[model samples]
Target: MSTQTEHPPAGGGAAGVAEPGQSAAPGATPRQTLTLLTVLLAVFVVPTSISGTAVALPDIGADTHATLVPLQWVVNAFNVAFACFTLAWGSVADIIGRVRAFGLGAGIYAVASLASALASNVIMLDVARALAGVGGAAIFSCGSAILSTVFDGPARGKAFALFGTVAGIGVGIGPSLSGVLVQGVGWRWVFALHTLALGLVLLALPVIARRTTEPRRQGARIDVLGSVLFILAMLLLTTAIVQGSQWGWASAGVLSLFAGTLVALALFAAVEKRRDHPMLDLSVLANGRYLALCLVPVAASFGFVTMLTYLPSYLTAVSGYSSGTAGLIMVLLTLPVFACPMLAAKLVARGVSALTLIYVSLGCLVVGDATLTLFGQNVALMAVAVPMLVTGAGMGLSAGLVDGQALEIVAPEKAGMAAGFLNTLRLGSEAIAVAIYGSLLATVLASRMRDGIGDFPGAGDPATVANEVAGGNMTGPASAVDASARGDFTDFLVRSYDSAFHTILWVLTGICLVLFLIIGALVRTSRDGREPSAATGSQAAG
Candidate 1:
């Protein structure tokens, strides 16, 4: 939205060619090209790290000897930190130069990743991953802002298109590539690889700093109190969701966590309202339509991202696939994401309804989650292929479309604030969705295992064994069962995991349908996802 009205350099001398006088023009083609590639390269790895780490969870658990409850932090920690700090990073980028913020973020990411690779225990690894998430927040939020700052008009569109594509590639291929690395090089290399890629980004920072220009905002502040409150609130809420089933939903600890989350949120809201430069711009959030569009990503988080993070582990445990094979199979579900954003955008541009595409996306998620129930012991791959593709396509279609549509309803100057809020919801929900899914899956698996395992001749504690299996250790605990009954117990573990997965899928279907209804009612967008009585110019309602 920061459309620097500057046109392409008249002579076009290599585009971005610095001249004797005048600041390096933003329309500098060569410089913009370098900036785009560099920023995209940094951002692509963020999603790869998000989707890929799950493939290595089992290995991390096996190596660290941790249970499911503690091990899930490996993913949750990163996501939660990213969600909480993203807005702060954006604000910071406004105060400091974007290039410096980017360099700082890249540095943190590289160091944290290196620390993660060297961690000796699960706790150490979780802390390191959380640090990386903080770094990732800056990279993800600031990268697009950088692109918006550097390129204008047609070139901007192309840059963002590539941005979305590379990110999708990262998400789509994360599981497959990670599985290979885990199998061939050990799990440590997973983080090691992140360190390596980000290091390259860091090395390019010198060139980037000299080439790019961002005017620092005069009076912007980071809103530390608001940031802390929001982060504490999210962490508490996620913790409560993760522990609710295990601690008894009504237990004092669970209730207290929920209560604490509410108090923190109330404080955050109050702080935002009072602050001169709040982390969350309350005025922007008052728009009903914009808020509804933000939820679109939340739906994807629950329906698709949950699957991306956990399905690999599920397949390895219940469907009898190795880590590498499970990752390969996941390609069927994630590949569509790589191509569908552009396809969806073109369709909208061609006069197809944007809301219609959203509905299609939501519908596909519902259908896909429901159809995935077909997966069970020895299930044929062909049977689940359609469901995976449908789900991934749903995710793909909405990729960057929601942000684009959301921007249409806001004043151009407020685009940054709106985007910040949308992404906060996007990533915050992802953290919660994944936490809840894993918790509920383990909860159900525990119940099933408890009901059936006690009857066996020589079984370990059902709760403990279920936790172990959920954390990706299937064989270690099977030793407790009598040799005659070991096979049956292992079979029971597989059946229980499959059953729990099916239950979770159904819940996801219901969530998606409800989201669709809520968004449909809120927008009143015509068949094409635009307002019925839309305004003429570039922006509609705003």
Candidate 2:
């Protein structure tokens, strides 16, 4: 069967797929609808696993008797694998068919989820989560490529908006759902539920979508060396950042990891430039507009996504809230995620420029991060809620448009590679952000706690006490010096956390400001200095 490239316009057309004011092609509606549903379900599954599993970390730790390092790995292992493999999968999807790759990925994800649920140890759980990330890479890489290929013009914008909304729901509701599961049933149910949902998606995929292939160069080869080098670089960098506090920043091991990362990155760039069919088209980076599109998400991941991962931990550990209460508080951070994407889509469809929206979003992020620095132990929930909403709105606006905008400039045939590259930056930066943020928090909290505990009688080893406090074990024997010291230590723990949180917020605020200026300078505009119409249907796809 020949592949159909002509999508129905936003208004009613030959294709029967009814978008707003549009009609689908004859016999196309059902397949189009099913394809969309499958992608949405696949997209929703991965992020839900990410945020939901974060909420269940405490439970996972308790049940597995995991230490701080192993617990961090449980989260980072997934992130690392997801980041490392997305670009590789994107190329693989293009060489094979997107639908086939997506199906295989869904199968892998479901199996890994089942394994995660049945894991008897922390190591086993980490391994399962990492495998799930491999699947997540394929799903994320192909999902956008498929959507980009299937939809065009205003329909594409609307489809991505709906896609963003689904993603928002997953990010917003996952923690709350996980809280319910962890509290009412068990943490294991979290993975079990994902397994069931994805299993169904896998079964329905073949029926919903037709197999389609992209035009590929006859001698094209996957850049295996580039992939290996990039993965090694990311692995070493992430390890150095995550373990810097524990290993001591100046220690030989941490320094060697950092050095190795630099060397690997250099080698990867060298190899990619020499290859005819590079995993990533480095030429894409030369385009200022595309570079901005790619890098903005990296900055946002540092400021926004990192906060999403850690805020729940803070709410439960430092603020003395239950996991359920923490989830409720997180709603403030996620609700706008669902709302802003649709708003952005409507605005773009009405001739508003995506560049303008991106600028506004980044501005919100800067303001939100700066505002969060003002929070303290006595700060009201509404205070945190306000900044979170602003940040969430920023995330929502950009998340929907960034991928679409990046794809606008790329050739349709290279859609998979572009999508993979975009996500590689997005998720890779997120993984690094977690490490950097975690490092800063650990280092500052330990130092502050050490100073606060200085000269306290019978407070054996300030480092040990600090570790216990940082780990949220405030009532343990390590933290209890005596009756009189207990109250002081409690006060110190709260104060130290406040200090660390403030420091992180301030640093993120700086990052946001720097990125805002850089993006403003880099993104190209029309001769009149107005935003370009590329994000709308005005610009033809390459």
Candidate 3:
């Protein structure tokens, strides 16, 4: 069969095969249409969840009286849980049945959102957000599996394309919709919005489940120990980042969290080495070309997703936009994601190399991030248009291409692990990037607060005020100022935030450029020194 027509055979996948009742027909049936829509709906929401809630952070902090440290959890917990549990959920789907897993995940997500909506404390909201993340993991992992069983051949490709598109749309619209929800209905309504959509998914679950089936993994043991260790490592690492800001970075508690993360990761490696069915096949890391390719999404995570998480806060706080306006402006950054994946694919087909497109993307990210320093307290839509579009385009170009291209060079048996690891790195890096950025921003804001503003009566603590300001609660500083100096104080705060924002963006630019040099050389040198596979899509792309 041509590569385009190929589809998986029975018992042919790591996730499991479609069972007896499942159709292998080439065209879509009403049942299949329903299944596809159901799966796509779930797919849409997961990425939306990842991107949306960041816009509501200011409201969340103000309402809950949380500082930036715990407030960071509102975003990090979701990313951490979703990234850590993704592969494990795939294993669970194979055992419990994909449809059952899908329904269960949707249920968990709905309940968690309800809890998030009702939570009066930031801690309660953070925990619920993490639960939503776990549910999101199952939704995407098994949602893909379910789609495979319901559609066949050409339609399968279309289904997956739509799957990716809907996901992008979800991400593209999440901030804006979330902003509107926060602005009009209040931040709690953001979680309530998810509850409403997911509730409908649950209503259709029984019908969706009846239309498909997959064989159970009779004796398959999930690498539970490996999963646990990975989760521990991620949780510890993110905790350290958030805490290093609130506590001194050199504090023993912060140091201990860092130490604990390293130990957990070391143990995870040891556990994976001994597992019969390791969640990750470590051997793939040796392929320098493959490793280099995986950095495509890493670049996107650091360059683009971090903006998704932080920029709304920036626009609202430093740029003096309302949350709704900030969300609308963010459309410039997210819109490219909706269309660029297909454009990249078409360019590749037209004889442009995927690796070239990847390099171009890195260029866009570095240039865009650096140029985005144009944003100031008087930010105009026109001033940010070019940079936001460039950054969004950079991310959009590589969203799905990297996965397929990365898998092509490795042995077929390793593809699943290769993919699982690639995505984990992508997501894990995103979570860390958000934490690291927030931590850096917090540190900068604090220093400026103490030095630039000086100590004023009723100012509270400089560090506490910085934390509050970072969470978009400028009232902390405002409360300290006399009415006459209030205008000057707010202006100074904006300047402080602008400087910090610029510093972070420049640092991120340096990281992107350094990575491009390192990975670009690795791909070129490694490809020349290594044997060419029957698949040199890497070479052609390189």
Q: Write the residue-wise lDDT of candidate 3 on 63-112 in tens digits.
A: 99999779988987897788877767765665556778789899999999
Candidate 2's residue-wise lDDT over 1-542, tens digit each?
Answer: 12334433211131222342234332345556677788989899888887778779999999999998888788778877888788888877766656777888889999999999999999999999999999999999988877766666676677778787888798778877898999999999999999999987888776645433233323567788998998888788877766786787789999999999999999999999899888777765655676678888887887788788788767766788887688678778788888988899889989998888888889888888888775666678877778888988878888768787777665555567878988888887876787778767877887887765674677766566655565566677334477777777677777777788888888988988998888767664332335443322223222
* Number of clashing pairs per prediction, in order: 7, 10, 0
Deviating ranges (above 4 Å) for candidate 2: 1-28, 55-72, 119-123, 183-185, 211-219, 313-323, 446-452, 460-464, 525-542
Ranking by TM-score: 2, 1, 3
Candidate 2 colliding pairs? 11-22, 12-22, 12-23, 14-25, 15-24, 15-25, 16-24, 16-25, 17-24, 17-25
RMSD of each candidate relative to the true structure:
5.6, 4.6, 5.5
TM-score of model number 3: 0.78
Model 1: colliding residue pairs: 15-28, 15-29, 16-28, 16-29, 353-528, 354-528, 355-529
TM-score of each model, in listed order: 0.80, 0.86, 0.78
TM-score, candidate number 2: 0.86
**Ten-residue stretch with the least lDDT total in model 2:** 8-17
The lDDT per prediction is 0.75, 0.76, 0.74
Q: RMSD in angstroms, candidate 2?
A: 4.6
Top candidate on TM-score is 2
